[model samples]
Target: MAQVYLSLGSNIDRERHIRAGLDALAREFGNLSVSRVFESEAVGFDGDNFYNLVVGLHTDLPVGQLAARLREIEDANGRVRGGAKFSARTLDIDVLTYDDLVGEFDGVKLPRGEIVKNAFVLQPLAELAPQHRHPLTGKTFAKMWDDYDKDRQKLWPVHFPWP
Candidate 1:
């Protein structure tokens, strides 16, 4: 089984969508290593705050298939496609990394670029897999987070209940 990390977020009906997303993921993947949910201001567009978290799972599915399954979960939870890239979302689940695989594989980039650019993605990811190195940078997620400018993007942990 390959280890995979995914980032999940929701703004519209935030709590409900995030919970639903997690439920779907756990059901499909059997078990999940979840991070504490963080509430952060929406980036790139004016919108409500988003609940973001990272989840680690083991799966034998290929990269493309795993991405497709995630998309199905989002769509089931009311995610709309063809919208502005950074607009509000009902649910957004992205493949952050597939094992230590690097570069574009099966059309999805591994060690997602957002891992370095967004506090919402990096903070929770670091909390979940602190020692997992970035496939390309070879830096631990915890180290990346420690060096991150927290002031650049505001985020805080929130109470979240899950199975």
Candidate 2:
């Protein structure tokens, strides 16, 4: 099974959306390691605070199929398509990485550049895969967490339970 990492977030009814997304993922992958919940300001565009978390899962599904499943989960949680990429949503799930494979995803790219530059992504990624190295940069999540500092000014712990 490929070890895949997923980042989950929402600003619209953030807690509920995040919880639903986590349940969907648990059913899809059977098992997963989820990171602590964090509250971060909207990445782009203006919106309410986003409750975000990252998950590490082991599954045999191909990257494309996995990405599709993530999108489905978001849709199930009331997400709409065709908005400004960062517009407010009920759910947003992004595939950050799939094992060591890295390439331009026909549908959704793995390890999207934003994952590396964003602390919300990095912090949970470090929690789940501290030792896994980035495909292009060859730096472990923990190491990168130490080296990089994105706009963390707005990121705060929600202390919301992880599933």
Candidate 3:
């Protein structure tokens, strides 16, 4: 089984949308490890602040199949296409990485350059995979996450019992 990490976010009905999305992902994947939800301002979007977190999933699904599943989970949560860049979303799921198997599709690369760029992703990811090393840069998730800049944005830990 490939250990996959995904970033999940929702600005519309923030918590509810996220909860629903989590439920959907759980139903589909079975084994899900969710990160503490972090509330942060919309980075590029201009609608509402979002509740974001990273989820670690263990599955045997291929990268393409996993991506399709992630997109479907987001779509089921009210995400609309063709909107402005970084628009507030009901559910946004991005495949951060698939167990170091890096490849490109639709012009985007797995572990996509954003893995090291966004704290919303790295923080929770570090929590999930402290010892897990990156495929390209070879840095452990915890190290990269701890080293990222968290200047203006704040990450509030979600303390609920995990799903």
Candidate 4:
């Protein structure tokens, strides 16, 4: 089984969607290593704050199939398509990385660019897989986070309990 990391976020009915998303992930993947949920102002758009977190799992499915499954979960939770690039989302999930593979596969970019650009994605990822090195950069997630400019964005952990 290949190790996969995923980023999940929600703004509309934040708590409900996040919980549902996590539940779906657990049901589909069997087990999940999840990080603390952080609340942060929406980036790249004007909207309600979002609750974001990262999850790690082991899956035997191919990258394309995994991406498709995640999209299904998001859609089931009311995710809309063909909207503005960044907008209010009931549920959003992206494939962050698939093992140590580099470049794009099955149209999903490995080591997603947002991993380095977005605090919501990187922070939880760093916390969950601090020692896992980036497939391309070869730097540990913890190291990249340490070097990240925390001032670029503001995010804080909230009380998010999961089963």
Candidate 5:
């Protein structure tokens, strides 16, 4: 089995979608290593704030299959596709890293570029897997978070209960 990290977020019906997403992930992947949920303003487009968090799991499924499964989970949770690149979402889950593999696999980029670009993705990731290195940058998530510009974006930890 390979260790995988995923970033999950939602702006529409944030709490319900976030919890539903976690439920689906846990049901499919067993126990998960979860990070504190954070609330952040939408990036790239004007929209409502989002609830975001990171989750770690181990799976034997290949990258392509795993990505497809995640999409199904999102679809079941009301995710809409073919919208603008940046828009409101009911559930958005991204594959961040797949056992240190880099580049695109099955059309999904490992160690997602958003890790370095968005505080919402990096903050929870650093909290969950501080020691894990970025597959391409070789920098630990903790260090990346420390180096990140706090003012570039604003996000704060929120009271989120997940089972």
Candidate 6:
């Protein structure tokens, strides 16, 4: 099985969608390493705040197939596609890393760029897998988060109790 990390976020009906997303992930992946959910202002567009977190799991599926399955889960939870790139979302899920694989496999980029660019992604990811090094940068997630400018984006941990 390959170790995979995923980023999940939602703005519309935030709590409900996030809970549903986690439920689907657990059902499909058997077990999940979840991070504490953070609420942050929407980046790139004007909208409601989003609840974001990272999840780690073991999967036997290939990269393309895993991405497809995630998309299905989002759709099942009312994810609207073909909208503006950063519009409000019912549920958003993206593959963050597939093991230590680098480059675009099956059109999904490993070590997703957002990991370093956004506090919502990096903070939770670091909390989940602090020692895991970036496939390209070779820097630990904790280190990256430490060096990131916390002021660039605002995010805070919320009271999220999950299974």
**Model 5: which ten-residue window has the lowest total lDDT?**
102-111
Per-residue alpha-carbon lDDT of model 5 for 89-123, expressed as tens digits? 99999999999998889999777899999999999
TM-score on alpha carbons, each prediction: 0.98, 0.94, 0.91, 0.99, 0.98, 0.99
Q: Candidate 3: lDDT over CA atoms? A: 0.81
Q: How well is each residue in 40-109 modelled by candidate 1, as lDDT tens digits? A: 9999999999999999999999999999999999999998999799899999999999999988988998
Which residue pairs show collisions in model 4?
none
Global CA lDDT of candidate 4, please?
0.95
Where model 2 places Cα greater than 4 Å from the true spot, the runs are 150-153
Could you give candidate 4's per-residue lDDT for residues 11-81 as a string of tens digits?
Answer: 99999999999999999999999999999999999999999999999999999999999999999999999
Q: What is the C-alpha lDDT of each candidate?
A: 0.95, 0.83, 0.81, 0.95, 0.95, 0.95
Question: Where in model 4 is the C-alpha error above 4 Å?
Answer: none
Candidate 5 overall lDDT versus native = 0.95
Candidate 3 C-alpha lDDT tens digits along 28-140: 88878877888777786556777888888888877877888878887878789997877878889888888787778554478766777777778888888889998888989
**CA lDDT for candidate 6:** 0.95
Residue 131's lDDT in candidate 5: 97
Cα lDDT tens digits, model 6, 37-82, are 9999999999999999999999999999999999999999998899
Tens-digit lDDT string for candidate 2 (36-76): 88888887787788888888889988877888888888888
Go through the candidates in order and give the clash count of each.
0, 1, 0, 0, 1, 0
